[model samples]
Target: MKVIILAAGYGTRLFKDLKNDRNEQFKHLIGVPKPLLPIGERPLISYWVEALKVRDDISDIFVVTNNHYHHKFKEWAQKYPFVTLINDGTSSNEERLGAVSCLQLAIDKFQINDHVLVIGGDTLFYEDFHLHNVIGQFETIVKDNNYANLVLSYPCKDEETRKYGILETDENHKVTALREKPSPTDTASRQACPCFYVLSKDSLTCVQTFLDEKKNAPIEEKDAPGHLLSWLVGRNPVHVYPVSGRFDVGNLESYITCHKYFQQNIRNIPTYLQ
Candidate 1:
């Protein structure tokens, strides 16, 4: 399997927060990319690199970034010879390719033909998250059907449903539908879907197909990766692996919360780098 980290986003929310803050300590972080921001002792994306480096299943690791931060990512990636950083050729959010488009770009640029594990650069899970467990689940499902794809989900508050991709799963945990930021009254299921996905080789082609179908639609409909998954549920078999929780570092407050949690529980969090 190949791993793709989506890191091309401009991080407008986090950048804005840092720029307007009066705190002098955080002033240096104003222009840093979200994925490169320090979580504890290492960058946010380094946690994933350290974890996946121990897994033999992953053949190649690719990080997709924008032109503005490409040089920074390249310099950081120099220490890790295994990683290859791809520039999406967009300097700002307005010109940036959406998440789905970036995924497609990575696939095309790398010529990946194996099962791909796609992860969000700015997100991490709690101590309960195990990559082996997720890969095991995917292997089991593929035994019955090679085209099956796996995604991660966790329970969230009812009011927070609008902040994530709400998933409606059946008794067997097969995703019936995926609603991107649905209203609170729309569904009773509070399973919030994260950007972590294990896409089968057959399902990778569907990424381009989904983009073609949405060529004429609004940008918002195709921007988030959740929208692509929402469209794939009906055409492919999508399964969910429920986890404890995840930390989405969107703003300064959320970043601090995740940093503190990782710092306080450093021993429990597996890095495999040691």
Candidate 2:
């Protein structure tokens, strides 16, 4: 499986909390991009990269980000032989493709047709983050000519349903409904997407086909992936696997707290390179 990490966004929420000290997600956390920010001397994304290495199933790693940070990412890429960094040529969200579009861009650039794993650069799965389990579940769903898509979600019960993409699943774990940042009253399930998703090549092809048709039209929806997933659920089989133990790094409080929490508890954190 190939990995595509969406790291292109400007992270406005994080910047607001930093009080305009800096806008880059990596830089603001530790005077670098959010991926490069150090947690107890180890770069924040380093942990995930290392975990991916351990899995052995993932062969290639790609990070999609703006051209401005290419140099910084190049420095990090040199340290990992399996990593390839691509510039999205976007300095703002207005120009950048939404999450699904970004992955489509990666698919076009890399010509990836295998099962691909898409992760949010802002979130980290703990060592026991239910990812491998979810992957196994996904394989089963797609095995017998079944669903073409599966998303790993988490239970969001902290009165913050509106801040996440919530899921409603059937008895068979198939996704029946999707709500992106739903109002409290509209929320049907506590499961929120924590950014871990497995997409079959067929599923991505369908998404790309839809995007091609939608590009000429105005963007009626804000969250591209959420909207796409909702649409896919109706036409194709889509499953939601519940994942536990992840922090939403997009939020200021969670950002600071994850850094401190991982620093004190995570044993695999590597030494930060100077």
Candidate 3:
């Protein structure tokens, strides 16, 4: 299995918050990339790197970032020789390629044919998230059917449903449908789908097919990776793995919240610098 980390986003929301802040403490983070922002003693993206290093099945790790922060990512990747950084050739948010396109870029650049584990560079899970267990579930599903894919989901509050991609799963944990940021009354399910995904090699081609089909559509339709998964559920066998919680560092409030949690409970975290 190989890992693909999507860090190409321009983080316009976070930048806006930081730019308008009156506090002097946040001045240093004005231009920092979300993934490279300090979480504890190390950068946020380093946590994911440390976690993947312990997995024996994971052979190669690829990080896709835009040209704006490409140098920063390349400098960080020096510590882990196994990681390869790819530049999407976009310098700003407006020209940036979407998450799904970045994933496809890594696949084509590396010629990866094995199972691909996709993760968001700005997202982190609680201590209960075990990569081995998720990989085990993927293996089990593949044994039953080669095209099966696995994604992580967590329950969100009713009011928070519109902020994420909500999922509805059958009794067997198979995803029945995926609605991207639907209204609260649109569905009864509160399962919010994160960016973590384990895609079988056979399903990689499906990504390109989806993009080709949506080439002429609005950019919003092809931006978020959930949009692709929303379309993928109907055509492929996708399963959901529930977890306790996850922290998506999109804005200043979320970044501070995640930093406090990691700073206070760093020792108890199974995946923290291990």
Kindly report which residue pairs in candidate 2 clash with one another.
Answer: 25-34, 26-32, 26-33, 26-34, 27-32, 27-33
The estimated TM-scores of all candidates read: 0.97, 0.87, 0.97
- Per-model C-alpha lDDT, please? 0.90, 0.72, 0.90
Positional deviation of 183 in candidate 2, in angstroms? 1.5
- The lDDT, on a scale of 0 to 1, for candidate 1 is 0.90
User: What does candidate 2 score on TM?
Assistant: 0.87
Cα lDDT tens digits for candidate 2, 1-274: 8889877766667766666545544444532566765665567677668767667777788888776566787898788878878788876646766777777789999999788888877777655564467677778878865446788777677588887778888898888888888887886688887766788766778768778767775554523467777767777887776656576677567777888887787765442111
Models ranked on TM-score = 3, 1, 2
What lDDT tens digits, residue by residue, belong to model 3 across residues 81-185?
888889999999899789998988998888889899999999988888888788898999999988999999998999999999999999999999999999999
CA displacement after TM-score superposition, residue 9 of candidate 2 (Å): 1.2
Give candidate 2's whole-model lDDT: 0.72
